[model samples]
Target: MESPLEPLLDGRTKGFPAAAGLLRLGQVGSMGWNVLAEDLPLPLAVLKETALRHNSAWMRAFQDLTGVALAPHGKTSMSPQLFRRQLDDGAWGITVATVQQLRVCRAYGVTRVLMANQLVGRQAITYVLDELARNPTFVFYALADSVAAVDALAAAAAVRRPGRSLDLLVECGVNGGRAGCRSLAAALAVARRIKAAEPYLRLAGVEGYEGSVPGPTPDQQERRIAEFVGFVGEVAECCADEGLFGADPVILSAGGSAYFDMVTSLPRQLGPRATQVVIRSGCYLTHDSDAYARAAVRMRERTPAIASLGEGLRDALEVWSYVQSTPEAGLAILTMGKRDVSHDLHLPYARVALRPGRDARPRQLPPDCEVTALNDQHAYLRTTEGADLAVGDMIGCAISHPCTTFDKWRFLPIVDDDYDVVDAVATYF
Candidate 1:
């Protein structure tokens, strides 16, 4: 069968240099184009190949140590190529936030999908049922935090009557979080409703997102996360005892990029119930320089196992842009801005600078230099006095949130340590 990714190999991809002229994505490696050498367009987003491999392996090792399965959230980098990498690296399944993302995974031949969010809406529900009926080998799971959601899904499943029941994980959420049931009692009620739906719907397990569980302090936050995980575990146990669980090994999933160690405690709480603890960490694949890096430090402090896993996750993604203008002292306008990188949690930071002909090699930008603000196509870079920055100097920036950044670009080149393009991945959104 022809690979689904073959279409993305076109030379017309956003970041591909026009001079390369209709080259295959795999052939980019042999073309000898280097980022620092100015072989491609500036304001380009690229992934460090070595760091990508390391992060994947590190997460795999973490899963092995914790005895849990990973269903890496696909919403972070809606790129099918990255999905292939995660699947090849031993991801149990690709977790998406929408039915459109599920379609992308299905188009690329992903056999298993976990829609981390609730599968609502008639169109979305019908699409899922169609897929389940078409592909016998396919496995899918979605979240449900309310009786209405369970009933909605059950209604769609009953109408289609696919070969098997639609699997659903009851979502247990925090008071002010995004989705899921706000209380344990609410979560159990939803799970029981799912069981009542019978042959149309199956209670797979309980799941939640701990990243939104707020804590006034770090200690309080950890305590709240523990409490939230415990709440989810309780829901699962109650459903199991009531014979509400439809799957043999009930799944207890929750874990964003941060606080996965605490989420791993689900298995311990289940206590003899056949369960599969799955962590849906999306950003761990291309861990950012800002938010997730700080989270990693806290994770190591709480879980000694991470520190012992050789070197930790490095920032694999970087956006390189030229210094469009150095109009005044201590100020440089970069070609990259909100359109190219991320600024949701923290603004992109200047990491390295390279002058095309004047510099011998790329040098680390001064610690005092920072991205003060961003415009649609320009960034306000505040440099320390005598920072040696000049017009035309390429500035490589490290983003804060990989999810937002990955969505901005349709394609990101995978580069080696020397900044040579090795491979490229295409994003759907």
Candidate 2:
């Protein structure tokens, strides 16, 4: 069978370069100009259909293999369309990192949530309590580390004790990372504080993040991640020993995209406990060609059952830019700037140079075409070979990390196999 993409071009140009020709004709006693559509908003990105489905299936399969319910972090891709697909795939819930993110998820019909971060401030507390009241069955779990955080949640919910109670998880931390109780003793102390202030807040489970911890080597990294997961298990047992949670299930949630393999195996260390393990990996959605690509390879070697997640998750996001100038013989200036794709992790990868309005497939550029530098609105690309790309040629760049790229566009158009726009996805932040 022929791939849908081939015929959709329909003799049209396979790749876009510079505008080919312009025609002027007079009709109905009027003179008008016809020019090829060469220019588009530069550095545009898209989510490829192939990669999207691959990531979705990979995460679900990972959950099935590990026996851990997936509550994939929603902060990675704020697209509600992605969230709906996850729910359909048997995800227990979606995990978010902020009050605003929860609002966006709730608005989009995500029934269960894990704030995954500390829910602070009266405004944030009020928003969470109100969400619980509005949707009685809607479950939300926030991180509680310090007494201040637990107190604020309890104080806010105290007003509506007759309504829903705030579900919470004690966040475990190692010395230098972000928010979490450093010691198991400290976590228990915080849980005690929450119990002391009942009816307002309830200790539901234990959660931690492994993304922040650094590993000296692959072996060292694995050891640290395993220890972190083990600590989360200990907290779960503590809650069980103390008989804190009544009818509700105790959550032993922790795992980011990079170290989920280590976290999911935590149950082996806990031994015969009935606690539910929830892996909150979000970046599995739009796996990058750079940072996440390397991590996925490692995960494949370690966990074979869910190895499909690492299979051909294309760098679907592309930045389309025009060559503005050829400077100093070896350099070309692009119309895209820093206001476009993220440069914090790394620069964008140049995929192809589309000729203007012409229909021939794009020939691969020489190895010298490098994304050398970026400014506010222009990207400096250095090239030594490949058909002297003149001014006005379109270049499609593959991105690295997707979290930063998503916020650049308010609305993203989804194209089908034929490259024809099919649907539009909106983002909250």
Candidate 3:
């Protein structure tokens, strides 16, 4: 099926200057705007059409092999078009961070949403309950790590009396983690509280994010992820035995982008609770070229089944910037910087380069080419010997974390393998 380009969200958009006009959604790229050909403005983010479809299919295959449903974390892209694609391809639901993001998914007609984060504040809580009351088909669930949070949700639900029960997953956390209960016992206690909340709140199941587990070495990291993921299942079993888990098809979700493979094998151990294990690894949609690439390698190493798929996730996302100046030998300043791409996990990788009116195919960057520094609007590209780089050359950078990189763009053009802009998607950050 042909992908539909979302209509121009608004004329006054940033990054892509040509978007400011009365343009047809499916025909914006009719003139064949090529990233390498310099058709769009500089510092533009683009997704490779082939790679995106391949990544989505790869994830679905993983789900099929494991018998686990997918509620891909929507916070990674926050594009309703992507969410729709994920669902249409067999995702269980969309996972979002805040109520505001949930609203965006709802606006796009998503019936089921998993609020991976705890719903805090009266306003956010009120909004969720009101929506559930208004929409009969809406299936929403959130995390509760502490009794205080469960109490807040229960009180808010009681006040709203949406005639609907709020589903909650008892979040188990690793020590030194950001959210969730640090121990299995603590998580179970919160589950009991959720059950006690009665009609206001229902103990849906157990959820945790294994990405926060601390491991000094890769081996240690795998061990820790396994341990935490195991605990989540054990807690689910305990909750079921204790009658705390009242929601059927109990949720046993615990898969971040890095260690999802470890989390996917949890259903067999979760006992016969009629549970559904959800892998919420959102970054798999736009696999990174650096950090997550390394993680995927690790996944293939520890699990031979994944490596058997030949090439796993490909680099689907890239940002284009021009070489503004060659300040010194082996050093070039690029027009793209932190404001355009992600530098939090690691600096963007110098993947490919295109010289306008010269290179037809994008050439891979030199082995020693690296982006060492990034200012607000400039990237310092440092290359070693045998590096042939010139001014006015377009540098295509592969990012590390799709989560942070996406917030920098309001709109991203979906491009084909030949760098032709075929469709576009709006970002709701």
lDDT over C-alpha atoms for residue 282 of model 2: 80
Q: Mind giving the per-residue lDDT tens digits that candidate 2 earns over 1-429? A: 221111111112212212323211111012121111332234555566666776777767667667888898888778777787778888889999888898888877788999899988778877888878878879888899998877777777887553866878999988667889988888988888887877777788888998876687987877787788778888777766776653566788888878787787655323333667888888777778788788877877777766544553445566677888887788889888787777878898776776766735555677667898889888988887654788888777777788887777644545444344444355667
Residue 73 local lDDT, model 2 = 85
**Which sections of candidate 2 miss by over 4 Å?**
1-40, 268-273, 308-312
Candidate 1 C-alpha lDDT tens digits along 1-429? 335475434446657788877765556778888988888887899999999999999999998899999999999999888999999999999999999999999999999898999888889999899899999999999999889888888888888989789999999888877898987689889988998998888998889899999999999999999999988888888888788887478888899898888998886445566898999999998999889999999999999877778899999999999999989999999998889999889999898999898777789988999999999999999998757888899999998999999999887889998898888887887
Instruction: Superpose all Cα atoms of candidate 3 onto the true structure and report the RMSD in Å to 1 decimal.
Output: 2.7
Candidate 3 is scored at a TM of 0.94
- On a 0 to 100 scale, what is the lDDT of residue 34 in model 1? 90
TM-score of each: 0.96, 0.86, 0.94
- Positional deviation of 369 in candidate 1, in angstroms? 1.1
Which residue pairs come into collision in candidate 1? none
lDDT winner, 2 or 3: 3
lDDT tens digits, residue span 91-192, model 3: 999999998899889888899999999999988999999999999999999999999999998888888998979999998888887798888789888999
Query: Considering TM-score, which of the candidate structures 1 and 2 is the better prediction for this target?
Result: 1
lDDT of each: 0.88, 0.72, 0.86
